[model samples]
Target chain A: MDPYALKKLNQCRRERRAALLVTDLGDGRDRVVVEGDPVSGLLGEAVEKAFRSDKSATVEVDGRTFFLNVHLPPPRLVMIGAVHISQALAPMARMAGFDVHIIDPRTAFASPERFSGVRLDAEWPEEALARSPLDAYCALAALTHDPKIDDPALMAALEAGCFYVGALGSRKTHAKRVERLTAAGVPSSAIERVHAPIGLAIGAASPPEIAVAVLAEIIEALRSRGLEARKGEAA
Target chain B: MPEEVQSEPLDPLMTAEDWMKAGKDVAIATVVETWGSAPRPVGSHLVIDGEGHFEGSVSGGCVEGAVVAEATDVLSDGKPRMLEFGVADETAWEVGLSCGGRIKVYVERLG
Candidate 1:
């Protein structure tokens, strides 16, 4: 690998982007290919497959072997509420290997002691998300039950195409949210994507159980997102 | 954050850059292919400095010594080579991987 390639790869890792290192075994020449960079031909198809599968492979392209090294950023869980469910969800999501972040403007709920070892931001979603910004690889769950806090984050998550967008509420409360989001001009298609009532319907009555349900749903969202995600991005 | 994402403090590629900046001739060994339960996945890195200091693993500490020795040659010659390891070593031609797996590691001098 070139020194510049290594630096670029590390930069991709830090900035939460995907990158592919393509090495031409025949000539010993290498270059870094970042997400969405176009390469036409059989090599481009192979590159797309490598990125989708998140796998590295040695391919015999054009009778000369090439090594494709795929680097995918870790999927992150950005919960837009520091409520009891988030307290439980934070650590559970971390244990399940999702980069977890919690945002709540309510400083009392976003206390360090309450959510130790978690990235807790006592700022509104608009301010905090501006710094970290959600992406397609993120799962956003709004659980504050307060529209003042959760609405902006939900709108941002919907626009960002977060893989999982869940909101905690009853059918009635969610209906009101839908109306508000529609009035705010969020696309009806995107607004419909939010998983109202959050979590899997596993009869999760308690906070921790709800956390488990939400994490399971997040995992499902990530794993089941196949070619459709790329198509969505391309569209 | 990369530490948590990497799950390890040392990333071989980053270390290779650091070693190069400190004026060391560096060789990088990458697992380009693996079959049947290879300990490390393909694309895993084991970067070796000219003095034989290494900061990653292409296998479960199985063939690294051999790779480092070969990397020493690669560092001196500035040539890249692919090394294949199987289950056992018979002729000093192939090393053992104890886990009954096979892997192809590509070693190259990085500039």
Candidate 2:
């Protein structure tokens, strides 16, 4: 590897940016393409495909084989509640390769002993979100039934274009929430983005089962949106 | 940026880079493609140093021995090699890939 490529790779790693390292097997020459860079050829198409799939691949372009090594930033999960469900969700999310963070204003619930080996932010949702803005690669879950905490976090997630925004509540609760959000000047379209009655209909009645359903739904949302966006770009 | 998030350890690439800095010859084997029933997904990596120590997995222990052997060659010669093993290829049983899947791994010496 050239010094310049290594430097760029280290920089991308430091900045948590997604990149693809292209190695031309014919000549052993390497090139690095960071996310959002203009890629304008067959190699560009390959890189774009790899980026969309989030998988490295061996692609043959014009009879020359090139290996696209994808380096993606870790997916992030921000849970707006340090409740029992979060206890199950945090470890599962971490195992699924997400950088998980649990936030709550309640010091007792978000205590260090409760979430050993997990990141906990014992601050209000709005304040926590202000410090670490959500991005498209993030999945936000408002697990606390309290409107004071969950609503602000949901709004912040929507504003940040989080890939998944789910709120744990009943349909009636969500209806009441819609009214509150609408009265608070939130647009209907934005309010609709929240996946109320959170998690898949897996008949999950326990915390661990509910955690599985929620993570499954989050993965579904992330992959479907990514695939759709890539299809639109390819079209 | 909170201190906790910043204090999180970097990923495996950084570990490989540190190994190189520490004067250990390192080679990385990446799963570039896979067929049916592959244990590890595409983009999975196994980083091996000159002493046969490895981090990460390419086949969930079904093929690490062979990959490490090939990586040793790559480290010695600095030559990049693309290797393919599968049940359909008859070498799969010998390599312990008997779970019926094909995988193409690209092994390269890293600086």
Candidate 3:
């Protein structure tokens, strides 16, 4: 427990930076690799791989085994409606290791009783998003099916580069929504990022089932995006 | 295997740091690899103090006892050990991983 390493680790945690602590089993030497730091060393490739996957691993470097301990900021989920689907989605998302927040200008639906252990922002999506900016680790879901509510949030999520942006609606509804977004000056490529029909094709007929499908789609997006980003880096 | 217990979102590194700050010897076991029906995913952690108290789960309940035992040694020797348990391993049945899955855990003393 070197004081220097401990200090750096605490700093990284405070800064919400992803990092890896590479520990050489042979000599008990430890080195910290904060995200965006150079990965050129004995543990370079393995560290890079671990960073991309956000998974820790034991790697053999030049015949010496080392453990890469990964530290990542918690994933966040921002829901743009306090509808029934959100009631189901919030708890499930929290259970899956996400910091869940629900934003709805409609205070009646966004009351504490509806979302009992979740953070609620009874403000408009734009105001809530401005207060808590979305990051690359965030997933945004628009479930109200009200363009006035969902469209602004989707636009904000796109601008913020959220890892996942999904909206609940039928294909026709999304088509109309896309047209409105395009008319509203959202780029076609950005509009393409929305996962309309929101969830996977799970034939979800109930709110809980729909919530499951949506969460699964969000996780898929997160993992697939990580893989694609890693591939792009390799290329 | 023990029934899977739902864990709240608590940061393992922070927990380990708090334990260390409180002057307790601690070891952390991480699931580095898994194959088939592994209860926990890679990067899952179980922090163990010298007195056998622990937080988090590296393998639901299948091989936690063995991991905790090895973590005790890690705390004493300040050394790290990589352990493997699965249906294919000799201690799999003894450790109750009978549901069939392989998991590699790396246990080490954490400051």
What TM-scores does chain A show, candidate by candidate in order? 0.95, 0.89, 0.88
Q: Considering every candidate listed, which one attains the maximal DockQ?
A: 1
Q: Work out the TM-score per prediction.
A: 0.92, 0.83, 0.77
Could you report the DockQ of all the candidates, in the order they appear?
0.48, 0.39, 0.23
Docking class of 1: acceptable
Better of 2 and 3 by lDDT: 2
Q: Look at candidate 1 and give me any clashing residue pairs.
A: none
Clashes of each: 0, 0, 0
| Regions of candidate 2 where Cα sits further than 4 Å from its true position | A3-7, A10-14, A95-97, A179-187, A202-213, A230-235, B1-11, B87-96
- Writing each residue's lDDT as its tens digit, candidate 2 over B1-111 gives 334842454445666777877888888888888988999988778888999988888897888999999999998889888888887776755785777888988888886
Best by lDDT: 1
lDDT of 2 by residue, A1-235 (tens): 4435756886796676888888887877787899989988898888987888787888999899988888876779999999999999999998887899899999999987888888899999878877777887889999989999988888888888888999999999999999999998889999988998999999999999999999999989877976778677789
**Second chain alone, TM-score for each candidate:** 0.87, 0.86, 0.87
> Native-contact fraction for each model?
0.60, 0.43, 0.33
Candidate 1 residue lDDT tens string, A1-235: 6788878888898788989999998778898999899988999999998998888999998799999999988899999888999988888888888888888989999887898777878899999999889998899999999999999999999899898999999999999999999999998999989998898999999999999999998998888786665778899
- What lDDT tens digits, residue by residue, belong to model 3 across residues A1-235? 3435756876786666788887776776787889888877767888877888887877898899887878877788999999999999988998788888889999898888887778888899988877678877789999988999999999989998889999999999999999999999999999999998999999999999999999999989877976788677889
DockQ for the candidate 2 complex? Answer: 0.39
TM-score of chain B of 2: 0.86
